[model samples]
Target chain A: MDEPEFIAALRSLPLHPGARNLEDDCALITIGNETLVINHEMMAEGTHFRPDADMADVAWKLVASNISDLAAKGAEPVGVLLGHSLGRDDARFLQGLKEALLAFNVPLLGGDTVTATGASTFAMTAIGRATHHPVPARRGAKLGDAVYVTGTIGRAMLGFEGAAHHRAAFDRPEPRLAEGLALAPLVSAIMDVSDGLLLDCWRMAKLNNQTFAIDPDAVPVADNARRDECMRWGDDYELLFTAAPGAAIPVAASRIGKVVAAGFAPLVLGKNAFPTADNLGYSHG
Target chain B: MDEPEFIAALRSLPLHPGARNLEDDCALITIGNETLVINHEMMAEGTHFRPDADMADVAWKLVASNISDLAAKGAEPVGVLLGHSLGRDDARFLQGLKEALLAFNVPLLGGDTVTATGASTFAMTAIGRATHHPVPARRGAKLGDAVYVTGTIGRAMLGFEGAAHHRAAFDRPEPRLAEGLALAPLVSAIMDVSDGLLLDCWRMAKLNNQTFAIDPDAVPVADNARRDECMRWGDDYELLFTAAPGAAIPVAASRIGKVVAAGFAPLVLGKNAFPTADNLGYSHG
Candidate 1:
């Protein structure tokens, strides 16, 4: 079975009410008066990074990606548990992990370490406390809401292409935690843009049973000349959200689209309707 | 770096107080009036199991092992997040996962599924709510406390050696959740016997600055003829705990030893004094 098939099978199992039907990036678990947001992410060698890539960057990226999921829920990180596979340059991995933990202001909780043959795979479970009630979700995008995205979408794509000036954007993507917190209360829907802006928008619109009418020119792109590639290229950890047209966003973001009632497609870019998500962004098998 | 060195390096990083200095099997995060016990465990192909192992058993074992850690803390499992690597027999894996979830009465929270090359690696994060204040810890064993173990040891070991009657012990080891809950208020210290009874005893003694003087004959083993092997073979998933001598123990467990003051060694099995943990049980690299 593939990822989609396996996930579908997983949905058939006993699921917690907080799972959000496994549709959201993070799980919201309530205990006592606090609601915790938890996210688990895995990065496999050769799948997430090059075999020759720096282990430090791999560790940093793993932590950042998981944190980005928590950010989408406007959660204040509590701690993280790491599942480490011991391999080459483990010291570098530790260094990067320390740096990431310090940078994100999250402490290490507890984890397991093991030795495995072949390519290394690292996993992390990030836990955070929700800062807003009725946590933002991808399925809450209301019709007529303005779609917005924080920061440029193509910096990571440029960096991956060996752009020296944008290298950090790819190696050390910054999670929009602050922005997520600021917009959580105002936004009708929210999610992180990890799987390309257009694809993520399509996912959000589809989840909400709404249509996203996006103006291609309105999206902020790191490289204006390669706008299409920038829009389709993923790894840019930006916040994509929807809010009332004139709502004060309280964060620096560009309004790129408007949510409409279910129409011809989930996503509409100018005159082109993206009836399907094929070739829209990165997808794991 | 090896597991020990890697973990030592991790100690230099920011650690939450709930981490228990990374010496325990689980982290304790107190949110509002609730204290959550969280555990993360990973199993890699070849490292944790044979390549030909059934995917269903592998999935069940993964969930069981993580739940065992939570059980050691006298915590009731809330839910679990899985990090699944898509590979051979994924349908079987999902089947086993569903069975485990149903058997344990624990709901699936959320997780990430990724496509990976080489040997597959699976990870799980089990979260639970503490049932008692001052939750059990490995470092709380006091002098004169009696060391007890629930169920017989070496069952998994026998099962691994193709003992038909013990197959379930190895493939679907039951977490001592109910036993742990009953013993929590009475036990001075507790942990699951995952890394051999002797090695885990040494660990608990070392952590508590005490010594475990065990009576080999008093310990229950699945195969008395291979009692030594049983004590050294890990993956039992039985609860190992220390309680005040002659206390009203509510669980049916074998009292095998007594906690003593720091001495020549951390563990003493009859006439043998184990100064080091080498070869006592499974140690992940």
Candidate 2:
């Protein structure tokens, strides 16, 4: 089975109410007066990075990606547990892990390590404390809410192409933690843009039973000459949110679209309609 | 690097106080009036199981192993997040996961699924709530405390060798959750016996600055003739704990040894001395 089919099969098993029916990026567990947000993500050698890629970058990206999920939930990170496979450049992996932990100020909790014979796979679980009670979700968008995105899109794509100035965007993309925390209480809906902007818009709209009507010319891109490609490339780690038209955003973001009633498509970029998510962004099979 | 060396390097990174300096099986996160116990474990092809091994058993063991760590902490499991790599017999994996969740009465949280090239690796993060204050750790065994183990050892070893009656012991070993809960308030230290009885005993003794002296005749084993092999083979998933000799155990278990002042060796079996963990049990490296 493919990724979607496997996930669908998993849905049939017993699920926690906080799983958000397997629709959210993170899981919520409320104990006593605290609600913990947990997220787990994995990065494989060939699927996520090249076999010859720097192990340091792989380690950094692993932590960043999982923390990005907590950021989308508007949570304050507590710590992280790592599931590591020992292989070449382990010292580099340790260096990257240390840098990531220091950069994020999140301590290493505990995890397991094992010796494996083939391609390496690393996994991390990020635990965080919810900063907002009604933590923002992808399915909370309301009709007429304005869509917004932080930072610029396509920077990572440029970095992947060896663009000198954009290397950090690809090597060490920062999760928009502060932005998500600030927007959580105000936005009608919110999510992180790990996938392409157009694809993420499609996902959020589909989840909320609405349509995202985006102005093609309004999205902020790293290179205006390649704006279309920028909007379709992923790994930007920006926050995508929807809020009332007159609400104070309290962050630096560009207003690029508005939430509309359910239409024939979930996303509309100018006059083009994207009825499905295929070919819009990266997806593990 | 080897598993021990890699882990030793990890100790230099930022660590949560509840990580117990990476000497314990699980991490503790205290928030408000609640303390959360978290455990992460991984299973990989070739390293953890055979290439022709049943995926159903793999999935079951994955969940059972992680839950076993929580059991050692006397925590009530809240939920688990899975990190899965797509591979053959996924339906069988789902079947086993479903059965394990139902048997454990734990719900599935959110997790990520990825496609990888070779040697499938699966990871799980188990989150639980502490049922007792001062949650037990590997470093709490006190002098004069009696060392105990739940259930007979070597069952999994026999099952792995195709013993029909012991197949379930290897494939679907049950975590001693109830027994752990019962002993939490009374035991000075507790941990699951996953990496062989001798190795685990040595670990607990070293961590507590004490020594474990065991009488070979007093230990329980599934096969009397192969007692030595039984004590050295891993994957039992039973609880190994220490408590005052007079403390009410409230559970059925065998007294295998006693904790004494720091000795020349960390473990004493009959007249044999094991100064180091080497050759005592399973070590991933």
lDDT of 2 by residue, A147-233 (tens): 999999999999999999999999988998888788878998888998799999999999888899999899999999999899999
The numbered model that scores best in lDDT is 1
**For model 1 chain A, the run of ten residues with the poorest summed lDDT:** A1-10
DockQ of each: 0.89, 0.86
| Residue A65 C-alpha lDDT in model 1 | 97
lDDT (tens digit, per residue) of candidate 1 on A37-85:
9999999999899999889999999999999998999999999999999
> What is each predicted model's overall lDDT from 0 to 1?
0.92, 0.92
DockQ of structure 1: 0.89
Give the poorly placed runs of model 2, Cα more than 4 Å off: none
Stretches of candidate 1 off by over 4 Å are none
- Sort candidate 2 into its docking category: high
Candidate 2 RMSD to the correct structure:
1.0
